[model samples]
Target: MQHIVTLLIAIVIFGMIIGIHEFGHFIVAKLHKIQVNQFAIGMGPRILHFQKGETEYSLRLFPIGGFCSMEGEDESSDNPNAFEKKAIWRRMTVVLAGAIMNIILGFLLIAVLLCTSQKVPSTVIAQFAQTTDATTGETITAAESERSGLQVGDKIIAIDGSHIFSTTDLIYKLQTTDAKSFSVTVKRDGEKITIDPVTFHNDNTEGLLDFAVQGKSKNPVTVLSYAAKDTVATAKLIWMSLIELVSGKYSLQDLSGPVGTVSVIEQAASTGENVLERVQSVLNLTIFITVNVGVFNLLPIPGLDGSRFVFLLIEAVRRKPIPKEREAMVHFIGMAALFLLMILVTVQDVSRFFQ
Candidate 1:
């Protein structure tokens, strides 16, 4: 029963994300007077569909993907209202709408999560971990961070030159970096201070974080401020991960497909000791996933909206359009390659289940 509930929740959340993304394109196209052929919530064969005023709305079988299919999106057409006939600026707006919607969805979700929390976490160091010395049985400050110059009440501003907006940024910087030490920057005594080569370690734990941060009482302003910062932090994390993947710091095994994502959602749903905690856990994951989707879709990969926008930019510069057939062929090839990669990743995800 729990498994079933988790699955249902995952499906609903995924549907909402995909729906909003497609709706962005659909609404923008409509506003620009472009003809939309279909607005779909999923891919593959249609499970349910209806037509209204020249547009077909569909719920398809595969929840892994969705589309807002504009008329003449992939081919030339004589219709004045076709997507290809749109002004370059209008077309670019339509192309970017999906990613913008995904990002907005992420920000909204983050706000929702913050509203239910007791306090907002800040990047200021509150206290360092303490442990008893074995020989003397006396309490001693054990946090390597503290001994390395991080102090209580100091607000972390950056690590290794990357600005820290929230605790999320602090954690990402600490966990993802391979360096044994870091140049930490903090705001203390109304001035900025840089601590060079600060090393964080623990005797008993393998984790690097050795200090706790203070939390601020939540107010409307703080909630909004923190939510926006966290959203940007999540998006930056996604972008950094993608760059690392391209640089060969990560491999195919590190990538997650729809199945793996659902599995992760299930785990998040089952986390925490209470219902509220579980919901917060799931919401946090959803925020990251939505932001990640937004950032990934904006990458200039063929068959994606970003690539289409690039082509539009070229058309604007040249004062002419690329041949429709050639563009369509390029997208087709890119789509095929993407599908193959998805299949491989899905297989890996399924194999993990058995293992």
Candidate 2:
């Protein structure tokens, strides 16, 4: 039951994201008075379809993805209203709009998340293990255990004298270091307080104590500042990830398509403690995918939007439009190659998902 609901959520989210993409082209094409044949959701045979005026809108059999089939989109059309018949500038706008929309959507979503306070963990010692008090024969705050000796509202600046970024980073240091006693630096209520490690784990995981970061919301500026920082950080992550992939530091297994994305949704649903956590995880994945979609589409590949811009630039340079047949042939070749590549990549995506 929950699985079905998750699937619906996945569809709605994908539709919103991809629909915005297609709408970019659709609206621009309409403004340019180009003839649009179909604005369909998905590929293959239509499962549900309708036509109003000249355009046929269809929901296709495969619910994986969608497109807007514009007249002369890839070739010159006889109709004066056809895409190829449109001016070079119009074509450029049509080609670039989808990617622009994706980027815009990413920013908007991030902003909304910030406005709603759907943020990373910022509270100190939000969760802790309960332990018994040996001296008083009563269960207290467990001041001597792994979560002990740490008071709330203490600002943490460093772990073992190393500056940390996120809560995850702080935990990583504790889980990675083997130091028994180290100086912890913090500012509690506007005073710098350095405390030696006192809490110790039973299993000696990293041979460390569990002193948490003390977070305070004394000022509203902190929230805005954190939100702005993370939004930019999220955007930068996308840029860096792509560079990493091209540099061969990232592997193909790291790539995910619809299959892999769905698997991730299911995994997060089970693994996350709350709906917000699951949503954040899914949105994080979506942001990466969205940025990749924008980035990949902007690449100068034959079938990509970037490649269309390239062809247009070439025509502009020569001061005459490229031959219709020549351009058509190139698009034909490009699309065929792209389709084959999609099949290959889809197979790889599914194989890795199962594995």
Candidate 3:
């Protein structure tokens, strides 16, 4: 019964995410007077559909993907309201709108998490830990950060030149980097100071995070500020992960498709002991997934909005559009390649379930 409930929740969440993304393109195209042929909530064979005005709205069989199909989107058309007839800037706007909406939704979800939280997490060091010495049985400093010139009240601003917006950035930097020591920048006494070789090593653990961060009381200003910062941080994290993947730091097995994502959502939904805790866990994961979707879609990969925008950019510079057939063929090949990759990833995900 719980598994069924979790599956239903995952479907609804995915529907909302994909629907909002397609709606962004649909609404923007309509506003620019582009003729939309169909606004779809999913892909594959249509399970339910209805014509509304000039557009055919659809709910397809597969919930893996969705689309907002504008006239002349992949081919040339004589209609004045066709997508290809639009000015380059206008077309670029339509192509990028879907990503923008996903990001906006991520931000809104982050705000929801912040509003429900008891305190907002900050980057300032709140306290250090003390551990008993094994030899003397006397209390000794355990926080490597304190001995390395970091103060309790100091607000960490950056690590190795990368700006630290919140604890999210701090934690990410510490976990991902291979460095045992780092050049840390902090705001202390209203002045920024750089501390070099701030070593963070403990006797028991390999983790670099040795000190606790202060939590601010929830208020309008703090909530809004933290929400925005966290959103940017989440997007940055996604981009960094992509970079790592391209650099061969991560393998294709690390990738997740719809099935893998559903598995993850189920795990998150079942995490906490209480209902509120479980909801918050799901919300947190949703924020990450939404922001990741927004960032990933913005990459200049063929068959994606970013690729279409790139073509429009080239068109703008050359004062001529690419041949519709050639552009369509490129997208078709890219889409085929993407579908193959998704199938491979889905197989991996299913194998993991049994293991």
Model 2 clash tally, residue pairs: 0
As for model 2, its CA RMSD to the true structure in angstroms is: 7.3
Residue 161's lDDT within candidate 3 is 98
Worst 10-residue stretch by lDDT in candidate 2? 202-211
- Clash pairs detected, candidate 2: none
| lDDT of each candidate versus the true structure | 0.89, 0.68, 0.90
Candidate 2, position 106, lDDT: 68
- Residue 31 lDDT in model 1? 99
> 289-313 in candidate 3: lDDT tens per residue?
8788888888888888888889999
How far residue 149's Cα lies from its native spot in candidate 1, in Å, is 1.0
Backbone clashes in model 1, listed as residue pairs: none
Q: What ranges in model 2 sit over 4 Å off? A: 118-235, 352-355
Per-model TM-score versus the true fold: 0.95, 0.66, 0.95
In model 3, which runs have C-alpha deviations exceeding 4 angstroms? Answer: 132-140, 202-206
Candidate 1: tens digits of C-alpha lDDT, residues 1-355: 8778878888988998899899999999999999999899988999999999999999999788899988888877899999988888999999999999999999888888988988888888898888999999998888888888889999999999999988889899989888999999999999999999899886458579888888889888988899889989999988998999999999999998988988998999989999999999999998888888888888878888888888898899999999988888888888898999999999999999889
